[model samples]
Target chain A: MQILLASSFGAYLFALFRKEFIYAGVLLQLAYLLFRASELGRLPLVGPHDTIVFFTACAAAFSLPFGRLMKGEKAFGNIISVSSALFTALALVYEPRNFPLPPVLKTFWFETHVVLAFMSYALFGVAAVFGYLYLKAPQSLAETLQYKAVLIAYCLFTLSMIFGGIWAYLAWGTYWLWTPKELWTSILWIFYSFYLHARLRQWWAGRPAAVLGIAGFGVVMFTYLGVSLLMKSSHSF
Target chain B: MNPLKKIYQILLSLNTSLWLLLIITALFIAGAFIMPDNPGFGSIDIPLFDWLKRQNLESVWWLWGTIGVLSLLSVNTLFCSIDSIIKKRRVTHWLLLISPQVIHTGFLFMLLAHLLGASGSYHGEAAVAEGSAVKLSGGDILAIKNIEIETDDSGYLSGWGVDIEYNHSGNFTESARISPNSPFIYKDLNIMVKDVQAYPEAALLQVSRDPGAVWALAGSILFTLGILTLIALRMKMEKT
Candidate 1:
């Protein structure tokens, strides 16, 4: 708990200074998460709510690599780092360690498949954020940066659906159930597909696409978090 | 026209993508909400609603359709990956090879493996504790040993848990408990415990296959590189 607080504080402080401080923030986060991972792996966390918290934290962690890509724009790293810290803090608060995996998640696909699917979902979550920001640029402030984020998110979102289908097939008798979760994901995929096309067409520019990117992130959240709780499906969460 | 110019033009166009995404999302959202209070059967009188389960949160249609869309996506990806490789775009090769875009290529492989390479199957029984092997049309058998209905710590049922053995082609045998979350995998096939029936024998499992999973890992690495490259370039541009 103390470590969580410290990491959060560190992320904020790093965000403020950015260039010099973000690395330290990232390092602190690694320290905190690595220590906590063992404890986390023991919990159930199978339901939709639990998966959301778990996936969000992972997405934040995945964002770390973007810092290296973002180059000298430590602000990018700072943003990803602090946001990840914030997500972890939120998870600790709302998601108790008790959300154990139900019987459904015990399958090979549920454990490994869902984990990968959600991890990709988490990564896309960040990409969606960056995508929104990119499409909404004051003057395409960081066009390349925005593009990178969108591309990354697109890949993750795409993978999440594909892997999810495979997992669904293993769990259910069919590969495409089009349940709420699947529907939202397909919708999300279609949106990204268009976003990809938009990028090719240069239609939305930064603002509309940015909004869509942000919105895509929301859909990603719906697929990852909302669908599980609100809808009933054969899926584990 | 030079290929580079054509490439730039195609890459930069957004109208096609934006409108298509909007349409797709609209249809999906509409499909999601128009559900009956009681799903699975007709809560609504519309005959099409029968064909289309209530777009309820619990609708089976949503699940089935998602699987379909993803399967299509995998095929599309496979086609594009093949095109990218065969069309011999020097720039695309570098782009796909260097950027997270390559992950898309890997994703194609993963999807193909899950879709075509694995088998999805289900498990069920006619009555409780009948303990008979659920037979598959493919000649495999899932023999049951016991049944336990699982629940939360609060005792609300999460789902069913079955201790069963899977015999494949009469040569391979392994034991696993098929519950909602705890599925069994054999020979790359994944078996999930969907439901159990009392009177008529019924068992459910979702199956998937992907031959290109390892490539996704490689694509992830390339994606990280692409991200770094773009970020680095952005920072450099900002500084200058």
Candidate 2:
């Protein structure tokens, strides 16, 4: 898996059509995820290693559909490849130890919540990249792609939160928790909600909207990783 | 402008909504840092409003401020949504005109759910060994019938379940199994097995009553539907 990821990065460096390499990496990761799930009898999303890999796979898979639109834009491809490689490399730093699924995570809603959440995160990630590319070269296509990506991501993120609420209610008896992670998740959601509304306004239509898109991903990362590392939360990984 | 008309205009403006949302986002960002130091500040075992009242005002001022602003935002959302529909009532694109209002309504429903939950909810937990029973607040009884646990070769718990029998008014009612993710519900009450012990065969069970869960679920469905509908409309507009 490491070698395939490196090859994708190298292909991007060589100015080759890198979509195929990313697709290959995504396939390998998916296969590994399935194999681990079969071995453990549960979804392999418990630890940082598994989740980061899953996140990278989702980002790579979702980025492909925008490949043609991003053609002739070298910086766009470069950003995607470099970030993918950086994230996969970060995943490698974590020990991939197998552990039994905890009682709280033993739910259909939990898995659904995770899958939808990460997929939405991946879409937001792609939108952030488009936002950056738009900054480099102001193009209507880039802006449109960013808006559409955010629109889809917002819907999916809402669904993920819904599933997560149900799961929490079933296990913990409350739909909302006052933990750091939950707070940051709300912040992320509200930030995007702000972005959505900003687009509809005249003053914030272009560059400010693009900047919000970029910063929105920062909120995503902080909500996903920073909160876990910096604060005590029920989220294990 | 008349003072009443100015206040109404402020409540019905999208600008007010945007600014309120931004303020909420900032307050939550502050809260994400503040909450970790004040553990139990967000505990679900107690009613949220009561918990907030018991805390130090210095530490919990952000929370109070958030609640206050959220109330304002809710009013703003309601007013804006109503005003939009009235102004755009003649527009041919009916779905486009109503989608934002639907989203606003969903947001209001969610806020209402939180309000209901914060004001009135019940939570209780008990550890019961096999053959022992715990009396509930409502004079009902819950007895542990059996405990099952499955551990892996490394002694890690792989699976577990607790069988519980419910009695109402000193009369036998029903028997059910409770496990993680599978809570037993009787009326508005929910019973979940939080932990299990092996040698002595004991389990930690939590019973809770949430009056807002249905509202939350309804709000979520509406929120998702509104967003999806808006996205479809926007995409269609872009295509043309």
Candidate 3:
């Protein structure tokens, strides 16, 4: 309770000092990562959503530093807050377990594959948020940030497919089965693929780009959450 | 034409492509909604004849891969959109030329490989009883290399395990198992890990062929690297 309270307060304080806030928030997030690790010892992350929370938390911690890299408007502090809030909420929904993974997920590749997957998902999630804002806001400090966010997000979605394929090869005995999850995820990425296309094409700039952001992100949510609820999670053996 | 003028010209025409995508996605969504949730083992025959239909099976035609037509439709939307971007030269040469773009091109190749990749299948399930030899997906002979089953204190759905070894086309040997999760890949084929069925020594597995498997792999590797570079760059920027 105290740790979470302190972390929330720390985030609030950092929000006030947006300039230096990103770095301060990152350090605090890193501490929180350690804090969670200590409580559970080793990695408390297990299960589908559990891993998502764990990696998103890490990505949130890392995004601050990444946001800092952007040239002009450095509003990573805001990004961090959003990410942290998301992870915190996710934590409420998913509980970490110590149980061993099912047979198909018992491989070393499973850990690497899933960890990278959730991390990328987290990054995409942030990008989706920016995409949403980019479409709605006529123009603001976030415009430049939104473009950067899409570039980064598209990159992650692209990789998610790549890693997913490799992981699929190792576990499911095939790379692309066109399963609901795989099919939808690939479609989601393709949607963004064109979003990037449009953005670079510059003909469909701004609002069109933002619309892609919404459509692609919706697909992501569907692939990540909707699939499990509607169908299944993990490709299975 | 000046670059800006050319760019504007392209923008004016994006409307057609945009409307087309909207129509396609809407139909896809509506079709998905109307389709039955569970389309049981409907006849999965390569060439469809109405009488060939499996009885009581209602799986969506699209869900069955339907000769990959549904996927191709979606793929068409993606390709057209990509073409529009390319035709206009709006591609971010710098970013797209980097590791991220490599990831995209890799994915495209992988999908192509999956669709056009050379692959084969195995039908008969292999049941090995603690060190027995059996044939796998292809005609390749595989032996139950090892078998170890662990039961928890109560042993209620805790799961079981087994290991398998097989010889590939050119004497290449591979093995797979759960609990540790190391699946074997032989030549272009992958004989993934599995649990022994009733005997705790036999294994069940799925087999496939996608000649472009390597491209899928390459795409994944590049994607990871691209992500790392982007994040790492961000981390470095935070430091300064």
Candidate 4:
């Protein structure tokens, strides 16, 4: 698994210069996931290591579409490559362990919830990359793509939260919990909602909105990892 | 401008929502940091608002502030949706205009769900072994019939489930099995397996009543539908 992850990271690094390498990175990550899943006899998205790798894979796959949308902007390709490589490297920092799936996570709702949630996180990562591109070049295409990316990401995140709520209600008897992770999730959602509304104002349409887009990825990262690391959360793994 | 009209306009403005959401987000961030030291703020056994009622002002001011801002935001959302519907009643581009209103309606429904939950929800836990009966708060009896624990070949715990019987007033009612995702429900009451222990074959079960579950599901459906519609419309516009 570590070798595959390292190879994927190398492919993404190579993608910084050649766009075709992105596909190689994505394929390697997918292979790693499949191999890990076959070994574990379940989805490998149980801990920080597995989920981060999955998220990186999602980002790399999403970058293909987003890369085309950006009209093959070299900077866009480079940002995605470097970001994905960094995420893969981060995943490699954690020790790989194949723990049996907990009974609470054996539900279909739990699996769907994790998949949707991580997919949104990946999309948000793409949106933030576009936000960075917009800030660098200030093009109408970059700004519009940033908004579109965020819009889709917001919807997916909403659905993920809904599935999570249902799962929690069935498993824990409440739609919402008062844990730090849940609170941070709400914070991330509200922050994006604020960004969506902020885009309507004349003063915030371009640079300010772009900045918020970039800042949102920060919120996502903190919600995904920081909450687990710094606080006592059910999401801690 | 008339004072009432001014207030109405303020409540219907998009800026009001942005500002309120910003405040609420800030308060939530503060609460996240504060929650670690103040664990009671997140007690799962009691309703959150009820727990807040017992907390002093200084300790839980962020929560109080969040509730206040959320209330204002709800009112703003309601007014904005009503105003949009009335103003766009004649527009030909109906889907474009109504998508946001649908989102607003969903938001209102979710708020209502939370309100119902906070004011009326009940939660408690019971530990029981097989063949033992426990009385719930509302007079129903939960009798554990069997405990099933499954393990993998490596001796790692894989899964567990509990079989239970619900009875009322010395009469046999119904029998059901409760697992991780499958909860046994009797009307509004829900019984879920929280934990299972081996050797003695005991389980910990949580009983809860959430009056808002249906409302929340309704709200989630509407919210998801509205967003999907908006995304479709936006994509179409971009294509054209």
Q: What docking tier does model 1 reach?
A: acceptable
lDDT of 2 at A6: 47
lDDT of 1 by residue, B44-153 (tens): 22222233444444544543454465555554444545555655557553544434345455545444444432232232323324367666657887677767655666
User: Which docking class does model 4 fall in?
Assistant: high
- Provide the lowest-lDDT 10-residue window in model 4 chain B: B39-48
**Ten-residue stretch with the least lDDT total in model 1 chain A:** A95-104
What is the descending TM-score order? 4, 2, 3, 1
How well does each candidate superpose onto the true structure, as a TM-score?
A: 0.59, 0.94, 0.68, 0.97
How do the candidates rank by DockQ, highest first? 4, 2, 1, 3
Over 4 Å off, model 3: A1-42, A48-52, A55-59, A62-83, A129-137, A235-237, B1-36, B39-105, B117-124, B135-140, B150-180, B197-202, B205-212, B218-240
Tens digits of lDDT, candidate 3, B1-240: 899866545444544334433444554453344343544222121222232254333444443443344344434434544564566456643443354444445555655564545233221233457677766544678777676666656562345556666677437876666432345555665554444555545565444344567766765665567666756666566589
Candidate 2 local lDDT, A64-157, one digit each (tens): 8886777777677667767877787788788775877776787899999999999999999999998998888888889889998898998999
lDDT by residue (tens digit), candidate 4, B1-240: 999999988998999999999999999998888877777756656666787788777768898899899999999998888888898889748888889888888888998899888888878888899889898865778999999998888897777879999987666689899887899977667899888889799999888998888889899999999999999998898799
Stronger candidate by TM-score (3 vs 4): 4
Clashing pairs in 2: none
Predicted candidate 2 versus true structure: per-residue lDDT over B1-240, tens digit per residue: 899999999998878878999999988877777777787665557777888888888677888989999999999988878878888899749999888788888888999988888887768888899999999987999999989998878888877888889999787679998877888987657899888888789998888887777788888888888888998998799799
Better of 1 and 3 by lDDT: 1
Query: iRMSD per model?
Result: 5.8, 1.3, 4.3, 1.1
The lDDT for every candidate, in the order shown, is 0.54, 0.83, 0.53, 0.88
In the order shown, what is each candidate's alpha-carbon RMSD? 8.5, 2.0, 7.0, 1.5
TM-scores for chain B, in order?
0.47, 0.94, 0.56, 0.94
Q: Against the true structure, candidate 4 has what lDDT?
A: 0.88
